[model samples]
Structures are given as structure tokens and as C-alpha cells.
Target chain A: MATPVLTVKGLTKNFGKLCAVNQINLQVNQGEVFGMLGPNGSGKTTTLGMLMGVVNPTAGEFSWFGQPPTHHIRKKIGAVLEHPIFYPYLSGQKNLELNATIKQTDFNNIAKVLDIVELTARRNDAYKTYSLGMKQRLAIASALLNDPTVLILDEPTNGLDPMGIAEIRTIIKRIAADGKTIILASHLLDEVQKVCTHFAILRKGNLVHSGPVDDVGKGEEIVEVIAFHDDLPAHLNQFQGTKEVKKDGQFYLVKMNNGFHSAELNRFLFEKGIVVSHLATQKKSLEKQFLEILAENNTH
Target chain B: MLHLLKIDLKKLTSYRTFWVVCGLYFITLGFTTASGMEFLKWLANKSVEFGATININRIPLYHFPDIWQNVIFVSGFFKLILAFMVVISVTNEFTYRTIRQNIIDGMSRTEFLLSKMLTNVLLSLLSCAMLLIIILITGFIYSPEIIWSEIFTDAGFMFAYFLEMFSFLSYTLMLGLLIQRSGLTIVVLCLSHMLEAIIKANIDDVTPGLIPFFPMESITNLVEMPFARYAFQEIQDYVSLTSVAIALGWLVIFNYISYLKLKKSDL
Candidate 1:
């Protein structure tokens, strides 16, 4: 049973002459890690801002949990948009307490969230003294103060080192495993690919593509093969499953139809008397699909 | 409402700038108002080149029916300190981007505006209470005779003082909302005061009646100068209803504009 956690209809925002977000309609379902993927200025932040009520939409409306959106509605949604916002003079624990106050939640939850973000040791230190990773974790802790059912994080791992990124990703995965509906927005397709069950791509304020992460770049499998023969492309094209074969310097790039395996292509080329020096199957990544979506929209 | 105020209290209590500004306001207001009689005695002891010596001690500066205006008039100058603090506190939300976060965390725009307004009111009430204590002690010590019936006389100035403080702080609040930067908001506040003064000076010769209606002018009029009575000069010895109404009117206008600014903008 996929209950709708959030539903946005024809949401739009315009800053003077610039259309930052335009006619965006989206639905986030329960117990799913939904990723909103877009490059900088593609309106991911703007859209999140509108959903959070910090940005007033020029048109349209959105609802939460099948009810109209309100400030009270937001109490159920924990969010960290753009940067980590807090009183720089306040300690990490005190900052989370402030969030708890606004959410009308228990102050006892502060300790739990701090422990989850692993900032328990330095919870008494002022926010201004915390490093970038610590500040980001404190923001995550603040967002989790209410144990919100819907967590919206924009660029949660932004500007963090590899270790910091892993820590946040681990926390997010743990939270999602608890059956919380999480909306993760990032420009990093790898992050989305690793954590998201469903994803949407936005380009120039328009939602270019949206579907399950598994369906990205469907209907095609790409495998790279290097053969010494100059007629490698011709030989690879003769395979029944081969959709197209293009030459890239010393390698032949083979696009295979659905259900076609690199093993089948290798056997076909081997039987055709063409021994391949190098052969590798390319995994269709969200990065490739994102770029293809952007490129596809660019041509239109 | 209490939750919103509690959130602001949590943010401000741990803020160093808030404490520093508050300390400055108390020290300056205390040093200036609490030393009133000593400063007057020191002025009276000075010798005069003219025939007669100047003595302000004999003027009954803290007498009943006069102490209210005297203390409030002097204390009113330090409203600028409270106004400065208000501007910084309001502008700090923008600088820290906490205002946006507060709303994102589930505060309505009206709640955010009301929270700041409630803080201003709290500060004003506290200031008035402190002044009342000081006035009572100083009045008892300096007054020649304690008249039981007259102690509450002219105490309307306390309400006037509160209105004055709240109105000025509300003005700064509106400016802080208009100009989201602390330094820039303070600069504009001071410059606007100077501009109003310049305009008042120039327009006094033509239309003095309209002067009392100006935002700052009306707030300043709330506590008329009580020193003129020491020179045996007649002063407006009581709080005027007109001035109070004007101050309250400006207060409402400032807050309404601030609320509109908050609602209309994308924080």
C-alpha cells in the first residue's frame, strides 16, 4: 500500500524575470527513498523551498499526508535545505533543542539524534566552532529532533570528504530502513543511485524524467570491446542482439538490445573467428541516464 | 505563542552578541538615570560669574507628580540602546538564515513576526519595571515629604515610557525587516533619525502642528521634558492622550508593515 506522503500540483516560482521553478508536479510515496536529482540552478532547492513554505509559489499548491500544507504540517516533515542553518553562538545540543521547541517534540529526543549523528561528544560546543562535517551532522540532528515521518534533505553530503559522506549515507540508509519516507535531493547522481529506490531528474526547471531507479536507461545494454581486426565493428554488427556498433579509436562500442548479455556477444564474436583482446560490460549508471536525459531535452 | 517565544529565548540566551548589547543597555541606562541627583548637586555647587549661584537641588526634582516624568524623560534617551539591540536581534535572524529555517521547521510567518514583537514587549515591560524601582527609591530619598495620596500621581508617564520604548523598538523591528543586514539596518535607523531631525528643524517655521504626528516625533513627545519645571517654567506636566494615541498608532503601523514584509517575501 503506497500512501502518498506529499503531493505537489503545478508548483511554480518566478524571481523577477527568472523562472527558477516552473509548473512542477510531484508525488512522494510512503516508505520510499525518493531522490530529486538536478544540477545547480535546475530548481531542486527552489522546489524544496516551496514545499517547505520558505519560498512562496507564484502558482499552484501542495499537500502533505493527504491534507493541505500548513506550518503545522511541516512539523511532521524534518528538512535541511541548502546550507546548515543554526544560531552560530548556540551549542549543538541547544540548537537541536530549539528545533524540538518549534516542532513541539520531546527534548529527550535531542540526545538520541545527537548519538545517531555521532556528535554526542561535542554536543556542548558552540555551532560556530564545529567543522563543516560536524555542522552538517548537527543540521541532520536538528532535522531528526521530531523523528519526522518525512525527511527532506537537500545536498546532505555536500562539501564533505569521503569519510563524512559515508557517515551521512549510513545514517540516511539506517533511517530509511526504519520505514520513514525520505526525499533526498542532490546533484550527485551516484549518491542518488546508491540510496534512492525512485528518482526524478529536473532540467531547466522542468522535470525531464521520473521513474524507478531500476528503470533508468532501460531497453539497452552497453558493452565495450577491443579487437585487433579493423573489421571488428562489421563483425560485431552481425550479431542479432546488436542494436548499434560504433568505433572509438581502438575499441568498438556495442549497444545491445534488452535481455542481451555480454557473454552472448563474446561467444558470437568468438565463433565468428574474431578473438577480442579486451572486453568489458558497462553498467548503466544513473549518471549516464541523467546526462542522457539532459542531452535529450537539450536537443528538443 | 509561548513556543515561539521559547524558541527565540533559546536562540538569544546562548548568543554572545545579545548579552553584550543587553549589558550595554543596562549599564548606560543605569549610569545615566541612577546618578540623576548627584549630577544635579554637582552642577549646583559650581560658582557663577553672575550675581546669584545656580542651585538645582532646591527645585524638588524627584517630588511626587514630577518624579515620573523626570525619570522617564532621562530614561527615554537610552531607548536607543534597546532599539539597537532590537535591530541586531531581528537582523541576526536574516544573517544567520535562521528565519528561513524557523519557518521551514514549522513556524508560521505570523508566528515569527509575533515572536519578535513579544520580545520587544517583554523588553519594554522589564525596562519600565526597572525604572519604577529606581524611581521609587530615588523619590523616597530625595523627596522632602512623603505624601501617601500623591505617590501614584502622574504615574501615567510609566505607561508613556513603555509606549515610547515599544514604539521605537517596533520602528527598528520594521527597519530590520526591510533591511536584513544588522549594520545596514542600524545605519539606516540612525540616518533616518537624523533626516527626521533635519526635516523637523526646517519645517518648524512653517507647520509646527504636523510635527507631533511624525513617527519619531510622536514617540519622543510621549515623555515631555521635565527639566523646564526646575526653571519655574511651565511644562506639559502630564502624559497627553494625543501623544499616546499617536505613538500607539505608529506602533501598529510598524508592526503591520513588518508582518506584511515577512509574509510577502520569500525568506
Candidate 2:
């Protein structure tokens, strides 16, 4: 495997008496869209802030590209923490120019990045005059100015309209498709599950669960069926490749082995003289898994 | 360092209030110097007798060695106008949160503090150069035959004026750092005058000789009042070395506070 683009070990931060971030260890490798998922106040922002060098870590250490944390190292990485940070007086192009200057990058790329964000037309408008979505777009555009290999975004879609959120997600996914390592922190589990290739769940500054997004709830293709009559799901285990079956209030959750699918199950149920009224092949959503992870961690 | 200042200048040049206040400072410098010269010319015409028959123009107020003190002392009053620019520049980063953005963009805390100090130095140099040109034109316009040798006589006051600006900027920067809002910072700055007065009154009441040693007071004392000499009143004849040292000391302290705050605090 390639070297980890970001290696955070025992990263913790405390705001006086409140431990904003406890010991959290995480590693994000190159070209992987790694999402830090948690609910509000779960320290997702603080962890991202500490990684971006905005909030000083009370304990532990982190590094970018195997080098110590320094301005030079930071120049290689692009990030936007909790808020959309820009001088509102400047034009969109001017704000990106400022970012380019800070990174010691070329000003020529400002046009290209503006185009990427679909903000080339509004490039001359002052940042204050832009809408809220435009401001967030501008922030992401600035983060892309240096053509950084690693992008860190904290709640990129927070407070954005649906259109704005879709636009940002498209841009982010495009960048990720281009083989850039993206470290995103969000409370939206669906967003993370959709955009990220790997994920880590944070609860009160602790890593509850983390792995490949595809690895979540693997080895089971559960199907939920609702029928007009009762006593039909009790014989579901008699079907071939059935692992387990359970019923919960007007729905039957059939845990099937790898060989069975919803179509096969429907045909067998029909052959068994049972008529199906509703059948939905259950796709285990990250939201359910995330809440389960949080609930389990809470009990411990 | 130049790159860091370039990073700062990129933002500063785009900042409107920076240029507005800067324009105000130079304009005020020109208007005040011209008005001072014009008023002195008016006094020369009025032939107003201060005691009995002495004309104000005959008092050598615009002469070479004396012109330095007169110009610098008046120009120093306009430091507030320029100091407000510094206040805005520093607070702009905080209010807009560009400082945190800049830090995330690749500027370290020390580089951030240094960029501001460098801008303060740049402003000091620019303002002092403008002051020099104004003094030269006004002095040559009103005074007798130029004695090239006496040009450097009161030049120390000119240097003192630059230090005074640099140090005052440091103080204003500290205020900006401590209070992040522009409107609030300005209010606190204005209120600080009375605040300083109260503190200095209480402190100086116990130690009689320490009032001149105050931070802002020492900066203001760098160039003694030149217009007051027109009233036939006594002033600090020479630039007080003690005051300059104290002002420089305060400058170091203010910058230290700014750096420490930026370094230690989570932006």
C-alpha cells in the first residue's frame, strides 16, 4: 500500500476543563476518500481543526506526508475548517488570488479553479455580495487553488441548499475521482457513505468504528417483505440458502446467504402459494450502521 | 519574509479601509503641514505681538533645526489616523477570520505576527518619507537661506517620529488582537485614552516622576510640543532619550503580547 497521506496518532485537544477531543488515532492513505463521521459535538470539527493546525492539540501528534507539521508542509495540503473563511470585501477571484499568494502558487490557475467550481462568471463579484452557497463554493475553490493532493473539508455541505450541496458533492467527488486523497468530516452519514471510499466514526472524540465503506455490514443481503397474510415468513428458512429469518411488526426480515436474492425469494414464495404484497431489498444504509455504532459505544 | 509580507500585502492592497485610512493619513499630513505654514504666514502678516512687538514669523518656528520638531510634532498627532488603519488591518483578519484562514493556508503564527509588523514598518517608512518631503518643501518655502549643514541637526526628531508611529502601531495591533471586532476595538481604543489617564493619574500620584514613562504618553512625548513654543512657553527642549527607550520598550512588549496571543490561542 502507498504511504499514508495523513497519520494522526493519539490526537487529543482540551478546551480548559472540557475535553473537546480525546485520544483518536486515524490514518488516511493516498487517493482514498476518508470520511470522519459523527454527530454534532462529537468532536468531528475539533479533530479536523487540530489536523489543520487551527486548534492546538493538547496531546498526541499528527503529520502530513510523513513530514512534521509546518507551514511548508501545510502549503501542500488544502483545507477549510468549520466555516467558510474569506475576506468578504474581496472579489471571488481576488480571494483565490490571495490564497494562491499564500501558498506561493501561480495566479494563472485562479481562472481554471473558478471554472471548476462553476464560479468563473461570478469571479469579479465581491465575496459579500455572493449568496451563502456561493461563499461555500468560493471556499472550496480556494482550497483547490494549489492543486493539492490532499483536501480536508469540515461539513462542506453544512447549511447549504440541496442544489448547493449537490454541486459541492459533485466537485468533491470529481476531485476524488482524479485520485486525490480527501479527508471529509461530516455529521451526514449518507454523504460520507456516498462520497468516501473509507470511513471512521467518531463519538465524543473517540474512534468507534472505521474501515472501508464497502466492508460495512458485509456478507448479508437482507430482504424485507410485507405480505397480506400471516404465517408465510415462518417457513422462509425452508427455502434454499436462507440463513435466518425474523419478523417485526408487519415486516419480515429474511437474512439470506450469498446465493439468494430478492427475485429468487419472491419466485419461491409464490411457488409456495404465498402472494407478496410488498418486497423491498434492504440496502444497509450507513445511517443505520452509524447509529448502531454510536448506540453500542454508548452502552460500553 | 518577503513572501510572507507578499501574502499580507495581497490582502492589504485589496482592503478598502486600509487604502482609505492611508489616503486620509497622507492627506491630513499635507493639509496640516500647509495649514501650519499658512497659519505661520498669517502670523507673520498679523505681526501679532505676543509680549510687546515680536512677530510670530520672526520667532524662528520654521527654521531648519526647529522645523523638524514642528513638523514631527504636528505629524505625530495624525498618527491616530494612520494608527486606525493599522487597527483595521489587524482586526480585518480577526473579524473576517482571514487570520485563521491565512494560518490554514500556510502561514505560521510567527509569520503572521511578522507580516503585520512588517506592514507596520512599511507604513512607518512611508509616512516618515511623506513627512520628510512635506517638511522639506514647507521649510524651504518659509525659511531663510538654507544652511545645508543644519539639515541634520534636529533629524533625531524625525527618527523619533518614525519610532513613535511604529510603536503606536504595535499598541494598536495589540488592541486589535485582544479585541477582535473593529467597532469594539475602536471604541476600546478611544476609551483607552481616558483609561490610561485614570491609571496614569493613580500611578503617578504615588510616583511623581512616572507619568512620562507611560506607553502612549512616552510615544507622544518623543517630539515635544512645537506649537506651544510659539506661545513663549517652555517645552522639552531636546528629544528625551529616556522617553524613546521607554517607548521602544513598550513596543517590544506590545509585539510580544500580539505574538503570544496569536501563537498560543486557537485561531
Candidate 3:
């Protein structure tokens, strides 16, 4: 197995008597896009802040490429936490240049980063002149100026329009494809499910669930079948291995037992002379798993 | 360190408010010098009317020079303005959440503190140089017999003044770190200066000697002459080297406290 690009073990942080981030362990392997899913004030920002060394961890330790939080390790990590704070009066290129200087990066990368963010046309514009989405892109460009081994972003698409979101998503996906480990912290579960291969769910400063996204809601295949008639729910249970059947107007929602296939159920229904208007098979979304985890925590 | 200093300079230079303040300083100095030269002319005329031996040759001695005196006088004004500017320079990083970014960008707390100190020192030196150039030009144009000795003496005064300014800026930087707001620190410094002035007014015997130890007093004494000449038999007795030492001591104490606070505080 390839070495993990980032390793966070038993990370904990406190703001006075209040624990803002409980003991949590996470890892992002080389070239993997890992998502940190959470709601507002769920300690997602705090955890990222600690990883970037902006916030001091009250307990536990983290290592990047098996090295501690030294300058050498930080040089290989790029991050955008919450909002991007730059010199508002300076041009975007100037701001990126300053960051590049601090990281001892090549000056030539400034233009390349601007091109990557599609901000090459507005690189000379002052930061205050840019729109919110443009500012966010510039912020990402600053992070990417060093061509870091790992990229950590906090809500990379928070205030972006759909078009802008697509643009940024494509950029992130491309970066990850280029063999850079990416850690995305966001409240948008759909985006996480679409872009990340691995995920960690945090709630109220605690890590509730974490692992491969494919393994989140294991052992079941959920299929939604819509029929032309509203009485289709009455006959839905005839399908073998059907765990539950629920009626939603003209549709019957079916969840099959572990190892059951949607094709087998469709074939069985067709053989029984029941016409299926619509049959769709899908893994449970990250949203469903996330809500389930939060609900479970509340119950406990 | 040089990279950090360059970033600091770039930030300070980019601020529109900095240029606005500089423009105001130049305009105010111009008005002050014109008015001061008029007053000197009036004094010369009055002396002639009173039948005093007011020779044209000695008029330069009585009047000093144009704008040179204004330049020295403006040091007090610039000291106050620059002190406030220095406070904002350090505090804004905390107020605007840039300090977190700076640290995340790989700067240690010590590096951050040292960068501010170095920036303030460089700016103070730049201000001193501008004031000196203004004085020399004004003095040469208005009075050919300008005393270079007085300029050297003024330089000495400003050296002491720079130390006092350094002390106040360092103390304000610490106060900014502790309070985490530029406005609050300014208010506190303003109120403290006023309170100290009131205290000095009521207790002249001891306050003049003691006030020099406070941050503001040290700055005031550094920019302006000490008033102890009127109350004491010898000027040297009142303006001891201890005052300068005390000012330096304040810088050390405040910087140490700021470092400790920065190391322990949560970002």
C-alpha cells in the first residue's frame, strides 16, 4: 500500500473549557480526495486550522508524509480555511507573489496558478475588485502556488454559483488526478459524494463515522421502482429478498437485503406479469448516511 | 527576515490611509511654517519699534529660520500620528484575522513580532530623515547663518525621541496583542496621556521627574525639551541618562509580555 500523504491521530482541541474538536483520527492516502463532512460550527474549520498549524491542538499529534508539523512539512501542504484574507489593496498577482516568496516557490508558478484558476485575465485586478467566486478562485490559486503534495480546502464552493462551482470542482478533480492528496471540508454532502472517494463525518466536535465512501452504508442495495398504478405497493413484497417496501404515490421504494441484485428483482417482477414503469438502482447517498449518523448520535 | 520585511513594506505602502496621512502632515507643516515666519517678522518689527538694537544681521539669530523650527515643532505632531499608526499596524493583523493566515503561511509568532518591530523602526527612521531634509531646505533658504550645531543638537534630541517613540510603539504593539483591537488601544493611550498631563499639572515638583518614565512622557521629552530647567539648579541633574534607560526597559518588558501572550493565546 502507498504511504498516507497525511496522518492525523487522536487530534483534539479546546477553547477554554469547551471542547471544540474531540479526539479524532483521520488519514488521507496519496492521491485520494478525502472529504470532511459536517455542519456549520461542527469543528470542521477547527480541525483544518489545527492541521495547518494555525490553531494549536490541545492534545494529540498529526504528521504529514511521516514528518511532524515542521516548516518542511508545511511547505508541502496547501490550505484555504473559511475565508481568504489577503491584502485587499494589492493585485491578485501581487498577493500570490508574496505567498510564493514566503514559501520560496518559483515566481513562474504565479501565472500558472492564475491560469489554473481561470483568473489569468484578472490577475492584475485588485483583490477587492473581484467577485466572491473570483476571490475564492484566487484564494485557491494562492494555495496551489507552491504545487504542494497535499491540498486542504475548507468549503471550497461555499458562495459560488452553479457554474462557478462546476469550474472549481473540475479544478479540484484535476489536481487530485495529478497525484496530490486533497482534503475537502464542506457541509455539502452531495458534493462530497460526487468528488471524494473517502469521507469523515464530524458532528459537534466529534468524529462520528469515517472510512471509504463506498463502505458507508454497506450490505444493501436501495432501488426505487415507479409503477403506472398507485396500488403497486401491495404487490412489491412478492420480490425475493426485499427488506422493506414503502408507497410514495405512484412509486414503490424497495430496499433489498445484503448481496441482492436489482436485476434479479426486476426479472422476478416481469416474470410475475407486473409491469415496472421505472426501476433505478443506487447506493445510499452520503446525505442519507450522514443524516443517519447524526440521528444515531442524538439518540445515544 | 528580509522577505517578511518586504511583505510588511508592501502592505504599509499599499494602504491608502497611509498616503492620506502623509499628505495631511505635509499640508499642516506648510501652514505652520508660514504662520511661524510671520510671527518672527512681527517680533522683529516690534523690537525695532521699542528702540532695541535690532540689527538686520542679528535678525537671523532672533528668528532662527523658516520652516526649520516648524519641522522641529512638527516632530511632536508626527510622533503622535506615527504612534497611532504603529498601533494599527500591529493590531489590524489580529483584528482582520490575517495573523492566523500569516502563521498558517509558515511564520512563527516570534517572526511575526520581530517583523512588526523592524517595520516600525524603519518607518520611524524614514520619518526622521524627511523631517531633517525639510528643516535643512527651509533653513538654507530663509537664513544663511543657520546654525548646523543646533541641527546636530536636534538630531541628538531626535535620537532620544526615537527611543521614546520605539518604547511607545512597542508598548502599544503589546497592548494591541492583549486587547486585540486598534481602537481600544488608541483610546487607552489617549486617556492615559490626558490623565498623566492632569497629574503632572497638579504636582509639578515630582511629576516632571517621574512622568519621563511613562511611555507617553518619554516620547514627549524626547521630541520636546525637558521643562526641568526652570525648576532645577542644573539642567544635567534633571535630564539624566536614566530616563533613556527606563524607556528602553519598557520596550523589553512589553515585547517579552507580547511574546508570551502570543505563544500561549489561541489563534
Candidate 4:
């Protein structure tokens, strides 16, 4: 694994008496796209704000590249908490230039970042004239101006249309591919699933799960075997590695305990006089894993 | 700090409303100067018909000079208008939620506060310069006999006026930061300006020397008074300087408290 670019330990934030963020621990590795998934007011924004140093933490500490919130380390971080608020009367290029001034970044990089967000053509237009997606893109451009090592985004695709979402996702993926750490906070499960390699599921300000995306749901890979079964075929038992068998309507569901070859299973069943109707592998989605986590928490 | 100042100046100049406000200031100043000049001319003619030996040269001294005095008057009024503009500049970031973004982008709370102060100071200085130029032109046109020395002396007082205006600007900026509402800030500023005016009008009579201590009043005194007033204009000069100091003292206190409040408050 790459070095941890961002480490958030025991992060907590309280708004008045309400605990907006409970003890949440997370980390973003260098060159990894980490996703923070939670519902509205679920402390995603609060957590991001704390990490960005805009919102003070009630408790806990976060470090960037092993350095705490110091001037040198903070310069390496760029963030977009919510909407991209700019001087509405100023053009997009001008807004980015102001951000550059604040960040002490090169003003010439404005066009490059604009082009990265596919907003090069709209650079001269006033910010108020941009569409919702375009505005979000401009915000992303502002964040990228410093070529920051860690880009923290809160709902980067929140209000974007389908096409805009796809575009932003592509841009973010490209940025991550360039070896920069990207931390995205979003409620869109599919967006998290598609874009994030590492995932942190936050619930009520607490981190429910944190690990690689593949390891979120850690059970045996279940392969659904659907066939027109009037009765359980003797050939089904001929399959050697099948762990458990269950009936779903007219189909038989087979859970694989180990690496069971679907082709071998099908061939073995066919040779034993069983007619196969359908067969496919099933993988649990991040949403399903998230809901299961929530269900388990509710039960406890 | 210089970079922050540059960004502020850029943002200030980018606002169309600023240009509109500046235009309004010039129109108001021009009209007030023309009207005041005409009224002085009429007053001079009446004094001559009455055989009171009214001298045109004395008219520039005893009566208000057409250019310098009018510039002072107009700029005083313009300060009230600029108060609203300054409030909008500071509070709009909060109202629009832009400060949050700025902070997240690595701008410290102190830097943000400093940026607004820098912008306010720049605007105040710009207004002061405009007032000076307008008065010089007004004097050159209508009150040619007006003592250039008096105008030059008063011009030096603009630095003091700038400081006073900056104190009020700082106070207003702090209010905007605290309330985070442009409308409320404007209302408070307007009420405060009115209260200061009333206090200034009654200062010599009631307080005996307290009027010059008020923030806006100190700026007015600095602009409207003769240079010799500092040494011989009763105790009012000493009181006025004290007022300017008090205003500046409040500015420091307000800014310090505001810095703490802003540092603690969530953007």
C-alpha cells in the first residue's frame, strides 16, 4: 500500500449539544480514491469541514502526510465543502484567479484546471451564468488549482445531472490516476461504489466500516444458480464444493464456500442428467453492505 | 498579507455595485458643490447691496468654500453610503456561504478578517482621495480666492480622516461578521451614523468637548476644521484628537474581539 496521505483519528464534532460527528477514524492512502458515504446531516460534511480546518473538532486529531494542521501541511490540502461560492459577478477565470491568489498558486494554471473540468470554454462567463453542474466543476477547478496532494470534496456530484455526474466522475478518476489522494463525501451509494477504491461508511457521526471496497462485505462469494427445478435433482448433490442450498421460488440458490468454478459445476450437473436454465455469480453491492451494517447496528 | 490585499482589491473592483456607488458619489458631490456655490454667490450679492462691504475673498473664508467645503460635506454623506457598501462586502461572504469555501481552501480566519479590513481601508483611502480631488477642482473653479494653504492643510487631515473612517469601517465590518447579515449591519450602521451626528451637533453645548471623540464625528472634525484649530480652536481640538484616539482604540478592541469570535465561530 502507498503511504497514508491523510489520517483522521478519533474525529468528533459537536454543534451545540448535538454530537454532529462521533468518534470517527478514517485514512486515505496516497493515490487512492476514498469515499465517505452518509445521508444528509449524517456528519459527512461536518467531518470534511473538520479535516479541512473550517469546522473545529470537539475532539480528535487529523494529520496530512503525517503532519498536523500546520501551515506547511495545510497548503497541500484543497477542499470543497458545499457549493462553490464565488463572486457571482466575476467570470469563472477571475474567481479561480482569486482562489489562486489565496492559495498562492500560479494564476496560469487556471486555464489548465478549467480544461480539466471541461469548463475551458466557459472560463470567460460569469459564475452566475454557469449551470449547477458547471458551477460544481468550477469549484472542483478551484480545488485543483494548487495541484493539492489531497482533494477533499463534499458531494462533488450532488446537484449534477446524469451526464454531468459521469463527466465529474471521469475527471475525478483521472485525477486519482495521476497519483493524488481524493476524498469524496457523498450520499450517492452508486457514485461511491463506482469511484472509490476505499470506503468509509459513516452513520450518525460514527464510522461503521472502513477498509478497501472489496473487503466491506466479508462473506463467501455467493453464486446464484437459477434453474427450473420441479424437485431437487440428485445431480445437484453431485456438485462437490457447494456449501448451502436454498430455494427461491422455482430456482435453487447455491452458496459457494470456496472458489467454485461455475463451468465445472454446470458440466458436472449436465453430465448427471440435470438441465441448467441459468447460472450467474452474485456479488454484494456497497449499498447492500451499508444497509446490512445499519441493520446490524439497529439490532444491537 | 500583500497577496491577500491584492485579492481584496480585485474583488472590490470586480463588483459592479462599487462602480455604481462611486458614480452616485460624484453626482451628489457635483450637485452639492454647484448648489452651494450658487447660494454663496447670491449671499455675496445681497451683502454688497446692503452696503456691508462684503469681500469676495472674505466670502471664501467666512462662508464655506464652494469646492473644499462641499467636498467635505458630500464625502461625509458618501461615508454613510459607503458604510452600506462595506457591510455588503463583508457580510455577503457569510450570507452567500462563500467564507466556508474560502476557509476550506486553506484560508485562516485571521487572513479572512485581515482581507476584509484591508479592503475597507483601501476604500476609505480611495474615498478620501476622491474628496480631496473634488474639493481642489471645486476651489479652482468657483472659489479661486480660497487659500490653497487651507486646502493643503486640510488635505493632510485626510490621513487622520482615513484613520477615523477606517475605525468605523472596522466596527461595521465586525458587526457584519458577528451578525452575518447585510441588512442588519446596514440598519445598525445607519442608526449609529445618525446617533453620532446628533451627538456631534450637541457636543460643544452639552458635552463641552465629547463630540470629537465619536468615530464619525472625529472624521467630520478632521475634514471641516481649520489647521490652526488644532492649537487655538478652544479645547475642541484636544478633545477631537482624543476622540480619534478613542475611535482607533475601539477599532483595536473590536477587531481583537471579532478575531476571537470569528476564530471560534463555525464558518
Question: In terms of TM-score, which candidate is strongest?
Answer: 1
DockQ-derived CAPRI band for the predicted complex in model 4: medium
For B79-178, candidate 1 gives per-residue lDDT tens digits of: 8878888888998899889999999999999999989988998899989988898889888998899998999988889999999999999999999999
Query: On a 0 to 1 DockQ scale, where is model 1?
Result: 0.86
When candidate 2 is compared with the true two-chain complex, its DockQ is 0.74
Model 4 residue B108 CA deviation in Å: 1.4
- Please give the CA lDDT of all the candidate structures: 0.89, 0.86, 0.76, 0.75
Q: Individual DockQ of the candidates?
A: 0.86, 0.74, 0.47, 0.52
Worst 10 residues of 2 chain B by lDDT: B48-57
Candidate 4 lDDT by residue in tens digits, B11-34: 878889878876786677556644
Model 1 clash tally, residue pairs? 0
Locate the minimum summed-lDDT window of 10 residues in model 2 chain A: A227-236
* Candidate 2 colliding pairs: none
Best by lDDT: 1
Candidate 4: where are CA atoms >4 Å away? A1-3, A228-249, A254-276, B30-35, B42-57, B62-74, B135-156, B193-239
Question: What is the RMSD, in Å, between candidate 1 and the native fold over all Cα?
Answer: 1.8
The estimated TM-scores of all candidates read 0.96, 0.92, 0.85, 0.85
- Please identify model 3 stretches exceeding 4 Å from their true place: A1-3, A225-240, A266-278, B26-39, B43-74, B131-155, B198-212, B222-239
Per-residue lDDT of candidate 2, residues A17-115 (tens digit): 998788888888999999999889989988887777778899999888887788888888889898798888889988888889889899998999888
